[model samples]
Target: MKKEKVVLAYSGGLDTSVILTWLKETYGYDVIAVCVNVGQEDDFEEVKKKALATGAVDAYAVDVVEEFITEYIYPTLKAGAVYEDDYLLGTSFARPLIAKKLVEIAEKEGAVAIAHGATGKGNDQVRFEATIKALNPRLKIIAPWRIWSLKSREDCIDYAQKHNIPITVTKNKIYSRDQNIWHISHEGGNLENPWNEHDESIYMMSVAPQDAPDEPTYIEIEFEKGIPVKINGEKYDPVTMLTILNKIAGENGVGTIDIIENRLVGMKSRGIYETPGGTVLFKAHKALEKLTLDRDTLSFKKIVAEKYAQLVYDGLWYTPLREALSKFVDHTQECVTGKVKMKLYKGNCVAVASVSPYSLYNEEFVTFGEDDVYNQKDAEGFINLFALPLTIRAIMNEKKIKEEKEVI
Candidate 1:
């Protein structure tokens, strides 16, 4: 009889590699490893070869970088979703796409279940399982960290060593990292302690702020319908555009943040994130929106952005609310087409100037110099109307005070 097959979200890393072997030994199931590429700097051929060598009956390397950029990254960018006002939801958005791919492969391969290496305490367990549940409710989910005896990374290292498993992590240096085209995040090891300063050697896609050059680098980005299309007057594809910006911004020590964040699992964790290109794009997009979007739309979108960030961070990407919010965000971005010049210096990306054809700013009405559209006399009525509630409240309070004095 053929053994039941389990499709694993295998990264060929220490965690998943160990999980692959353990899944076979523990459950007597054939493990099929699936590695989905979202633009991380990894050799897919090597990853596939490693998976097969590590006892996977079959292995797949799925390339979804372009789809990830266009579908996942761009939508989040358009929504302006920033978690807790700082995190750009890089890992948050990527998880759902990865889970979706796993589900697709599992269905095709006739796998009985999908297994993952997400830890029990971390938010990724929820992110991965939630997407799996939402997409295909019938497939069984196996999380090795939640069920296995290995308690910590050290234990995992020991297990890998005992099994003669090919591994990269060791007790001396073990940092759990997640990387993609948008950003890279570092956790575990010294990062677990909030008080400990992150070592600069951990910097992968960016430089330390203090080490940045003294001179500022300026670049202009153009957006069409809230999507970045060109940089410095050169048009490029989404992947190329982001790659170019990452190189420029990373050199300036941009988009590195060491934060102690509240995970969805009801615990706090410290992690360092590098998002050089994403930071520049977000700043440029906001600058363009300021020029094109009206006051009410921008103000309301701020609230929408907060909620959207929360939804994405919580792995609710496949839900109805996320779809509705994306639609609303798309509507708001109809006029969000423009160019923004940014100044990058020592980890700071500031929008120096912005322009849009749909800009609501009227020089004639607000010019400091005398102009035909000048309405200096209109300010009196405008201020009174704007402050009418305050005036009415003051009048009511005065009348009450006078009546009280008379009674006394």
Candidate 2:
């Protein structure tokens, strides 16, 4: 008799490493480990070796950095989807792509079940499971964190030690981290306490604002239909552009955010995020949009952006609503092509200038200087017409007050 095979979403990290072994031990099932690379710095060969050594039937490392940026990252960037007005939705968007890959591999391997290391309390569990179910509803989902007897990171470490599984996490430095091309997020450990100041040592992609160099760095970014194309007059592909920008922005101490955010699973979690390149891109994109997008369209798109952020945050990427929102976001981006100059200093990414061929801003119409495009006399009729309802309401109220005084 042959054992059933399970596909595991394996990161070469403590939690997933332990889960990979535990799944095999607990169920007597053959585990096939799959690691999807979205530009996180890691040793793929070592990850594969560890996966196989930990009793995985097979191990696969799939690189999808370009697909991740162009397909997942760009759309979210174009939509300007910032969760809770601060979060850039970096980890939020990456999960769906990983889940999609997991399904694809599971189908190819003829695996009956897929497993993940996401804890029951965190948002990633929902994200992974939601995406998997949406993509292939027939596949069985196994979430080890929900079922495992291990209560905390300490217990996982113990299990890894007993099983001889190599892990990087130490009990002293146990901050849970998720890194990708766009950003890196740190949570758990001391981060669980909201009052505790985030330990600067945990930062991987950026320097602390106070420790940044005294001099400011200026850079120009060019965009095509809301997607960043070039930096400082040098055109780069998606991966290279982000890599260069990350280094530039990181050195300047940009894109470090500490926030207590509301989770999709009805709880609040505190995290510190470093999104250096993403911050630069977002700042540049918004500056360009200000020049190009009209008043009404921009205003309405703000509402859509909020909803789009929520959808991604809640792990509903494969749904119809998300697709529809993407279409609308794409339409808005048609005129969002432009160039923006930014000054980066001590954690600030400020847009100094912006220009676009589709810019709605007319210098002659807006300037206070004398111009043929506008007349000061035109304001009287415009203001009166705009305020007509208020004027009538005031008159009616005055008449009613006078009548009341007479009657009294």
Candidate 3:
């Protein structure tokens, strides 16, 4: 009889490497490793070889970086959804795509089960499982971290040594890392302490601010419907454009944020993230939105953005409401096409200039001198009507005060 096959979301890292071996030894099942490349710069060939050498019956490396940026990154940025007003949602955004790919492969390969390395306590396990269920619920999920006795990184390392699997992992550098096209996040290690300061060693994607150039670097980013289309007037593919921007932004020490964020699994985790290109794109998109969107739409969109952040962070990307919210966000992006020039210096990405073709800015109406576009006297009736409710409330309050004083 043929053995039941399982599709594992593998990264060629220590955790997934050990899981690949463990699944074979414990379950006596066929473990097929699938590694999705979302532009983390890892050598997929080497990863595939390592997976095959360890225990995987078959290994596949799927390139999904362009799809990831276009489908996942762009929509979130267009909506201006930043988790907790600080997190760029780099890791969060990648989870759905990775999970979706894992499921797609699982179906193609006719696998009975899908497994992952995400721990029970982390947000990613929720994200991976939620996406898989949403996409294809019939497939069984085997989360080893939740059930296995290998409770800590140390145990995993010891298991690797015993299994004679050649790998590179140390106990001292225990900060869990997740890297992709949008950003790289560092957690665990000393970051578990809320009061601890994030050292420069934690940053893997960007240089330290102190090591950045003394002079500021200026760059221009062009957008079409809130999606960044060009850099310095040169158009490129979604992946290449972001790579160029990441290099430029990182050299100037652009994106580095440290925060203690609430995980989806009912725990607060501290992390340091490096999001060079994403920072530039998000800020520029928001600045363009300000100049283009009307007051009401923009204000209401701010409220929507807050909720949108929660939804995405909680692994609800495949839900109906997320699609509904995207429709609304699409309308807001109609006029959010433009170019923004920014100055990057020492971990700061400051917008210096921004303009959109559909911008509501009017020189004549805003002019200090006399202009035909406006009649100064028109403000009198407008103010009176606008203030009517306030005026009535104040009069009623005065009357009530007088009655109280008389009674006293």
TM-score of each predicted structure versus truth: 0.99, 0.99, 0.98
- Which residue pairs in model 1 clash with each other? none
Candidate 2 matches the true fold with a TM-score of 0.99
Off by over 4 Å in 2: none
The regions of model 1 sitting more than 4 angstroms off are none
lDDT of each: 0.94, 0.94, 0.92
| lDDT per residue as tens, model 1, 122-142 | 988999999999999999999
**Candidate 2 local lDDT, 1-408, one digit each (tens):** 998999999988999999988988899989999999999999999999999988899999999999999999999999999999999998999999999999999999999999998999999999999999999999999998898899999999999999999988999989888999999999999889899998898889999999898999999999999999999889999999999999999999999999999999899999999999999999899889999998898899999999999999999999999999999999999999889999999999999999899989889898887898787898999999999999999999999999999999
lDDT of 3 by residue, 1-408 (tens): 899999999998889999999999889889999999998979999999999999899999999999999999999999899999899999998999999999999999999999999999999898999999999999999999999999999899999999988778789877788999999988888888888888896677789988999999999999998889899999999999999999999998888899989898888888899999999999888888888999999999999998889889999999999999999999889889889999999889989999889999889999999899999899999999999999999999999999999999
Q: In model 3, which runs have C-alpha deviations exceeding 4 angstroms? A: none
Clashes by residue pair, model 2: none
Query: What clash count does candidate 2 reach?
Result: 0
In the order shown, the candidates' Cα RMSDs to the true structure are: 0.9, 0.8, 1.1
Q: In angstroms, how far off is 191's CA in candidate 2?
A: 1.2
